[model samples]
Target: MTVDRSMIRVKAMLIAPNEDTSAHAVTLNVPTAENPEGYHRLIGGSVEFGETHREAVRREVHEELGAAVEDLELLATIENIFHIDEVLGHEIVFLYSGRLDPLPAEAGATLTESDGSVVPVVWRSVKDDADPLPLYPTGTQDWVSAALTRQRP
Candidate 1:
């Protein structure tokens, strides 16, 4: 096995919860060529050059959510290998679980990407058996469940 730096991407996901931990904040991805229907994903972005993973997470959260996160604890590091529009890609994801200083309203909000595309950010019930929208990065639901359980008292 060999590593290719060009194919590698770093993503920082916030496992943000509400006052009672009923739901979490997730972004509704815009439809792309690879996925016509799009999917729900953690609020994060790719790490930029010369930025540490932690800094990238914080920056991305602020940029995407317009808020600050606290008590960022590394929960998992996932090696994600998948195909998008027949193009093979890989990512080294750093999953961070933390809380939002001021939880947004239950209705959630929208975020605009650098390209001027609008993304809907919403709070979804984590206990749902069948999610109407697909969660991206494959196994994120399970990871969130386990993390939430571990966080409970």
Candidate 2:
């Protein structure tokens, strides 16, 4: 397969056994250089030179949660057009799903950029359409819809 260089980011929707595959949602505030509220950032990153999509997903999860994924399943590949608020004009997010049954007890995860910061992780239902949800790249609606409808992973 020919890898496209245009969209250069990868992410994983780290999930656990929820209420029969309930809606899985997590919060991440993107920190501003100056802000009183203080924000959170999602778990994700760009693809490295010698990394595959699966590897990137694992790396991101470890960086964010300080845990390695023992069970990961591909849900779907959804292409999206994103108007990024952090980086370039657009990015294509490669979505993957992994199971983190017993959540890690560590206080934080390590990152090459942030030098390792502590962030909280949570699990929520994604099946509720009426409820407001927070997505990482902001263009994840298509991916979410695809994941919820696909076969059990």
Candidate 3:
């Protein structure tokens, strides 16, 4: 039997907070033809062969943000099927929660992708109503909501 690598993808993402749990870091994807409103999602990248999701998330954080993550914990595992710019996509996403070292600026940070594309990273409110862009990979806000609720008395 042969495995088709292109059939599905596995990704490791982080909900990395700075000093406060009120906001988490996310990359802003500007508006496109298919998504005129644009969106925001956790910062992370693909999981490589022979690597665990934990390792991938850490490496991705270091590579993309130049920061280390602490207090890391698995938040959720979601299976997502969606279309981006009219192209179908499927992914098994591993989401993690953690704190970032050398906290990012309140205004935001910039991300340079491996492919040489630049994107902006901003701290978005954990509350769904307060966030300006929709967080993708589906199910992400659910974890944020649950975490926020636990943080409250």
For model 1, the superposed segments whose C-alpha errors exceed 4 Å read 1-6, 32-36, 151-153
Cα-lDDT of candidate 2: 0.50
Q: Write the per-residue lDDT of candidate 3 for residues 42-133, one digit (tens) a residue.
A: 89988999999999999988888788988888877889887776667789999888888867788857877777788898988877798667
Give the TM-score comparing model 3 with the true structure, all chains together: 0.89
Between prediction 1 and prediction 3, the one with superior lDDT is 3
lDDT, residue 63, candidate 2: 64
Instruction: Sort all candidates by lDDT, best to worst.
Output: 3, 1, 2
Q: Could you arrange the candidates by TM-score from highest to lowest? A: 3, 1, 2
Best by lDDT: 3
Clashing pairs in 3: none
* TM-score for predicted model 2 compared with the true structure: 0.59
List candidate 2 stretches off by more than 4 Å: 1-20, 23-25, 30-42, 84-88, 104-119, 138-153
Which window of ten consecutive residues has the lowest lDDT sum in model 3? Answer: 144-153
Give the alpha-carbon lDDT of every model. 0.75, 0.50, 0.81
Error of 1 at 35 (Å): 4.9
Clash count list over all predictions: 0, 8, 0
